[model samples]
Every structure is written in C-alpha cells, then in structure tokens.
Target: MFCSLVFCSLCFWHLLVFGNSDTVKTVSVSVTDGDTITLQNNDSQLQDNYLLSWTFERPESRIAEINKGARNFLIHDGVPDGRFRDRLKLDNQTGSLTIMNTRTTDSGLYEMTIKSKKDDTYRFTVAVYAYLIAPVISSDSSRCFSPLSPCSLVCSSVNLGHATLSWYKGISVLSSISVSDLSNTLSLPLEVEYQDKNTYSCVLNNPISNKTTHLNTTQFCHTCAVDSSEGHANCCDSVEAVLRLVVTALMGVAAATAMFF
Candidate 1:
C-alpha cells in the first residue's frame, strides 16, 4: 500500500511541475509609454532546457531562438530596425525574451514552441500604443470665401510621436489624420457651419489614450450664416446690416413730420 501511494504521488507531482506539454498557451500584453516587455516560456524547473523557439507570425517574421544542444539563446539577425534590431534581449538562464523601447510597428503575434517531453506552443499578441495630447482649434476669425461656405478651422496637435487628430461635430467626424512621427506636428482642417447651432470639438487619440477640446464658435467668429450647395444665405447680413439702415431712415422722417404738425 505504501509503494502504491508513493507512485501516485510522484505521477501527480510530475503533472503539476511540467504541466501538459501538448497544450498550447496564449498570453496577451498591452504596453504603453514606450516601455519594455518580457516573455517567458518555462518556470525555473525547466529553464535550462531552452527547448522553445520564438517566432512572429502575423506577417511571418523570425524573432529569437534557443539551442537545445548548447543551450544558446540569441535574437535572429537581418530583422528590420522597425521590428526589433538591437532592442531584443534573450535570457538563457530563464528562456525569456525582453524587448526594449516598444513601438507601434512592434505590435503583432509572437509564438513560442517548446520541444521537451511534449511539444508545447505559446503565443503572445502584443499591442503597443502612445498617449495623445489635447488638440487645439485655431481660425482666422474671418469666414473663408464669405458666410455661405464652411469656415476654415484648423485642428492640430504638437509634437506627438504616434497618434490621430480629428475634428468632430457631435458624434460625427469631419476629418481625421494619423501620424507616427511629428515631422510637422500634424494638422487637419474642417468647415464649420456657424449658424447650424451645433457644437464642434477637436479630438486626439490612440489605441490607449484620448484627449479632447471643445470648440467655441464665438471665439473664432460671431455671424450666423448657412452655406448650402443650393444657395448661400447670410442671416446676419440680412437681419442686422440691411434692415437696420432702412429702419433708422424711416424713424428720422417720422420725427421731422411730427415737429411740422
């Protein structure tokens, strides 16, 4: 009875320590702020084996490799600087991979296959994003091409590394632009209908971060004008400019007639 008990205990212990090698495992990681990330295949018990081979598969790329015979670990050569380059680190002691300075192009599926007592595959999908800054809305305060057309307003962000800037009227987007590098700081233009009584806003965003600024039409311009493809109607000019002159002239004539009476 004692011998049977010992055998069962040893079998369960093996299962717990080694786990099911045939079963493939998956891990998901979200990296932000241009940080580093590490991926591990095995615990300390089987760390020295180096039986796992890491690969990037969405676009079919090579990542890092481990030799079972010499227990050597190295990141593959010829990978583009946009992919990994000198930023990859492999630990032979624990069979883990660390990538330094993660970028948007580094986002993809990474797979690891282990050939120990059983064949196991591990997959990691990495998503990297940068935080976006608040967008600014600027205009000349002069309606472009008169009041019938959309007033030209510029929405932009300054020195953003990787992000998208957008102009919005409520939930609808008028325009959006995505830039990885801030060669020019990025800007997008939109035409706003000042007489429409609708609120507008500027938005900057990424997969992980978002910032917004509401646009006040009063700050840019103060006239009510609706420009339609059918026709341009200057509401402010008709109500305030033309009628006010006629009404003032009529009031002067009435006072002259009253004094004569």
Candidate 2:
C-alpha cells in the first residue's frame, strides 16, 4: 500500500507539469491603430461555476476577470497604468476579451486563464501598427538637360511606424526601402524617360495596411518639340505664337465684315 501511494504521487507530479502544456494555446495577432481586436478563450461555452481571468504583459497584472459562480464580470483596466481604461470589453458567454481603439503602446503579450474542473490558458501576442500615409511623388528637373532626357523622380513618405516604401512599374517592383523607426522620412528614387508609356506607382505599407500613389509623368515632365533653327526651344512658345496670329487674323476679318454690312 505504501509503495502504491508513492507511485501515485509521482504520476500526479508528472501529469501536473506535462499535461498542462497541452491545455495552453498561443496566438499572434496584428492590427492597425484605432482598430478593435478580440482575443478568444477558445471555449465554446462556459459553465455556471467557471472562473476566467486575463492579464497583460506580466502575470501579476490582472486586467480582466469573470466569475460565473459569483455572478461577477469585472475589468481591471484601471490598475495597470490605466492604459486600457474604457477600452476593454469582456464577453460573458465565451470569456473573450476585446480591445477598442487600440494604440501602438498596446502592442504586447496578453494571457487568459480559465479554471473549473480543468485549467486552460491562452496567450496572445498582439502587434498594433500605426495608420499608413500615402507617398508623395516629385520630379528633380535639375537632372534633365533636354526634353528627351530621363526624369529623376522621387517617392517619399513620413513613416509613422515600421513600414516599407517601394516603387512599382506595373506589378513588378522597381526599388524599395524600409524603415523601422517610429517617426522618419523615407524616400525612393526612380528614373524614367519623359515619353515612356508605362504604369508606375509608389506604395507605403506596413503589416496591417498600405497606401499607394500613382505616377503622372505628363504632369511632372514637360515634353518640348525640337526646334532645328533655334537649337532647343520650348514647344509651348511656338503654340502660343500660333494662337496669337490666329486671333489677330480673326479680328481683322470681323472688322472687314462689319464695314461691308
């Protein structure tokens, strides 16, 4: 009988450490700022006498709890630095926790514990990224010597968080640059012919969202017709001279017709 009790104690200790590993689950979630995210308990339903608790960052910092036996559902968001105050919601049925208006500071580890006849734990690693901004496209006219010269264009954006800035020609990427700083200015350069016909775009993106800006070559790079006599003259000047001559001829014709009438 004594040997049997010792064997039972050893078995219980082994199960306590090893068996509990299977009951724990971990998940990784990514979300954008000002968005809401829910961490599920993985429990389809809760019993009448179950206890559920949630902690953030560390185990000792309890942020939420639910006690069905005591008929209590409490959110302790005010305890841990008040970062989650008025932003946390708890589901009474599934014991899932939801965070509203999530910010970048909320990116961290969260844990959930459920106790009844069995113990179940859930871990979530949440990453909240800032909203992305559209990139701006500009041309460097100093690099252009003639109308046929390649235009040097730059794509730039203010990085609110970790993001990648890329230039794409159609669907293929031409070049890219990445920044991990919280606040920075990122720029990517691309050169193309003034008359080249191709779809181009600049994109700024993060793990959660992306923004794009289409390139309009005609708006930035002005095409001028070659004047053989004057070497190199702006086409706009020739067009304006023709328009003035036409206006002068039309005025003379109108004056002659008025005199005849």
Candidate 3:
C-alpha cells in the first residue's frame, strides 16, 4: 500500500510539470510589413533544439521544401502579385521574418509550427495590423492687426497624419472643447482691448501625435476699419469690409454668446 501511494504521487508530480511545459510552449507573432512577418518561440524549457515551419491558409500552401535529411526552412519567395513575396524572410536563430513594404491586401491569418526532435509540436496564431490614416494639421498662417483692421489667422489640415484637431493661444486654449474638426473657424477676445497692437498666436494640435504648431500675428482690432484715405472708403465698401471684419472676430464669441443670451 505504501509503495503504491508513493508511486502515484511521483506520477502526478511529473505529469503536472510536463503538462505545463507543453502548454507554455508558443511563439509571438508580428507583421513587419505587407510582405514580411516575424515569429519567435516563447518556450523556455531549455529544450535541445527545435524546427520552425509556416503554412499559409487562404491559399492553402506550405513554404518549406523537402530535402534529404534537413528539416523545412523559410525562404524569400520574392514579391508576388497581390501577395507578399519578396518581403518574406526568416531568421532561424531568432525565428523572425522581415516583410518589406506592406500593402492592404497582405492582411491574413498566419500559423507558426514548432517541432522538436522528440516529435513535440507547438503552434501559435498572429493577427496583422494596419491602422487607418488619421487627420492632421498641415500648416497655419496669420495676419497682424491694424488700427482699423482686425487680426486673423487660418489653420488648415490639408493632409492627414494625426487625429482630432484643435487651436490654442499660449497656455490658454483659444478653441472650445467642441472644436474638434479640420478648418475650424475662430473668433478671439483680447484681454487688453486698446489701440496698441499686441502679439497673438494661433496654435493647431492633433490628438494622435499630440503635435502642435503656433501661428503668431499682431492683435486685430475689434471695431476698426482698413486704412483708406477716403475716410475708410464710401458707405458701400465701408459697410462691406466692416461687416466682414466683424464676422471674423465674432466667430469665437458665438460659442459664448449662447450661454450669455
């Protein structure tokens, strides 16, 4: 009875450790480019040596070629039409592959298989990633203020690199929390309202890269007219220009006006 109990405990202990070692064996996978991928074995049981192989599912093919005594190995198949070819390379030592210049069509499920001399086989799956290009702020320009003319600036995100757009002035943000789109119109209120021209800045920021750029200009007048020898132009032109200036300056105020009214 005693011998049987001791033998049973020993068997249980060996099974526990061996079962965990088998379960822990796996490989970490990543897609480097449209044509390249990397796979690394995570097993740390200190096994003697292992063979790594890959199989493509959708096309149903194997990359390994048969040789007399040597096991299957990864080789560059060259760039394939609508398929990753020249981009595939395998690092036997580290079990990694570099895919150069990835394309959208390269996305697919991949499988990595590892085999040991003892016939132990391990498999793992890797999912590829390619994020959609986000919005970006390309450039901004600003104009200084003149006695009769108000200051103005334009922020445009012609192409996208980052996401979520905003404008700022110094430490204080000039845009509202709701300001989150490209080519947003702005109106500003200067703390010091007077004839003396003050320097102001317009800042553009994107959420993804958290990048910001400032456009500086002299303070624009709130109720000023463009300098014209003929008393700020005749009634028609004067009204038109004044109306345009007011409209630009009032943009920022509109956000606060709703609360006040």
Candidate 4:
C-alpha cells in the first residue's frame, strides 16, 4: 500500500508538469509604435484546448494580469509623456498587435504571459519606442508682402515638442533661436537701403523637424513712374511717350537757333 501511494504521488506530479508544458506551446508578438503592440498566435495546432493569456512588466516589476480568452491580448494605456501611448493593437484572428507612432520613451522590454486550459502559463518580452515628428515651417499668409513694405517671416512646427529653432540662408545658418512652446517667429530686419529684388529664404529646424519659408521684398523708387495699365504693354508705352517729349523739346530749340543763323 505504501509503494502504491508513492507511485500515485509521482504520477500526479508528472501530470502537473506535463499539463503546464502543453499549455504554452508557442508565443509571438508584433510591435506597432512607441505605445502600441500586437500579439500573434503562432501555435494553431494545439493538441488540447487551452486559454491564451498575457501579462506585462517593466524591469524588476511585478507581473500584471491581462485579458484572457482563446486568443488573449492587452495594452498599456497609462503611458507617460515622451512615451508611447494609444498605439497598441491585437488581432484576434491572427493574434497580433499593430503599434503606431513609436517614440524613444517607449523603449522597454515588454513581456507577454499566456495560460492554457489546464491552468498552465507562459511569458515573453517586447520593446517599445516613440518616433518623433519633425518640425515644419509655416507663415501667417502665403502672400505676405505688399508694395514698399517689409513683412515678418514666421516659422512654426507641425509635430515638434521642446525643441530649439534655427534660421538659415540656403545651406548656411543665419541665426539660432529657441522655442518654449510649439510656435515662434524669426523676424527678418528690413531696411529701405536693402533694396535688391532677390529671393530670400528663412529656415526653421529642430533636431527632429526641419523646414524653410521664402520671403519676397518689395521696392518703391521715387523716380519710377506709374503706368495706368500697370504691368501691361501700357508700361512700355508710357515710358516711350515721356522719352519722345524730352527729345521734341530739345529739337525745337535747335531749329529756332538754326533759323536765326
């Protein structure tokens, strides 16, 4: 009877070990972005029915229980700033998560835990990240300048956070500025003496985002005449008329002197 009891105990222990092993046959996952991830079911051909489960943990942290089902999944919703957020997905059919907008703060070893119908469990790790959006240049209006006046060139960001600013002329940097918020302006100094009809550009840059804005300067001269039709053939016609009047006055004086002679 003693030997029989011992044999029964050994068999029970084996059954427990074997049951646990069969539950976690395989585990796989997919990374979305800084905050989102997808877990996939790599093992389709399980010999027995098992409940798939998941768990997440940071380094040296306690395991957090996740959702459970035939295909189980979970997401880390409470992510901090500069970290990944709202970017994890799990496909029930395929058992995968589609991550979105990965960032540097999202970098960490993520773990996935699973359980089977026999109450067996398994775990795996995933890394997360936060991808930064580069800055872009913007202006209050596209047609910023009017005749004989200087307009301010403003630069802003589409997707930038806590970044420095810079101004450039083509390849060369003109100045460097900082922005506490998302928007800031670098106004170019305009002088009446600085009258060259040249195309100018101001560049805005953060480490992640970079962009440029163009500025056109308008000129007004005192000696310049205004044509009624403005920028048409009448402009040339008006200049020709003024030139003819000057020539006629000079020639009429010369004819009177020749008649006296």
Best by lDDT: 2
Over 1-261, each residue of candidate 3 has an lDDT whose tens digit, in order, gives 011111122222122124533432333243322333344334323233566555554324554322213644546353234365656666545443444565434544444455555433333334343322322232122222334433334444333222334455456665532242333433333232334343334333332124444443322223334457865533323445677789978986887788888
Q: Cα deviation of 171 in candidate 2 (Å)?
A: 2.5
In terms of TM-score, which candidate is strongest?
2
Tens digit per residue, CA lDDT, model 1, 1-261: 010111122212122224644666666666664677777654543534446677876435667777766856668834644457787887666566787877666777887777777776767777776645688888874433334446667888886756888888899988888888745487898776747678789989876678999988777756655678648554544335556579989999999999989
Clashing pairs in 2: none
Model 3: lDDT equals 0.40
lDDT of 2 by residue, 105-167 (tens): 899999888988888777777888888879999975533224445777899988568899999
Clashing pairs in 1: none
| CA-RMSD of model 2 | 14.2
lDDT of all the models against the reference?
Answer: 0.68, 0.79, 0.40, 0.41
Better candidate number, 2 or 3, judged by lDDT: 2
Better of 3 and 4 by TM-score: 3
The lDDT ranking, best first, is 2, 1, 4, 3
TM-score of each: 0.58, 0.72, 0.42, 0.35
Show model 1 residue runs off by greater than 4 Å: 1-21, 45-50, 58-60, 80-82, 142-154, 157-201, 214-261
lDDT of model 4, residue 57: 49
Candidate 1's C-alpha lDDT? 0.68
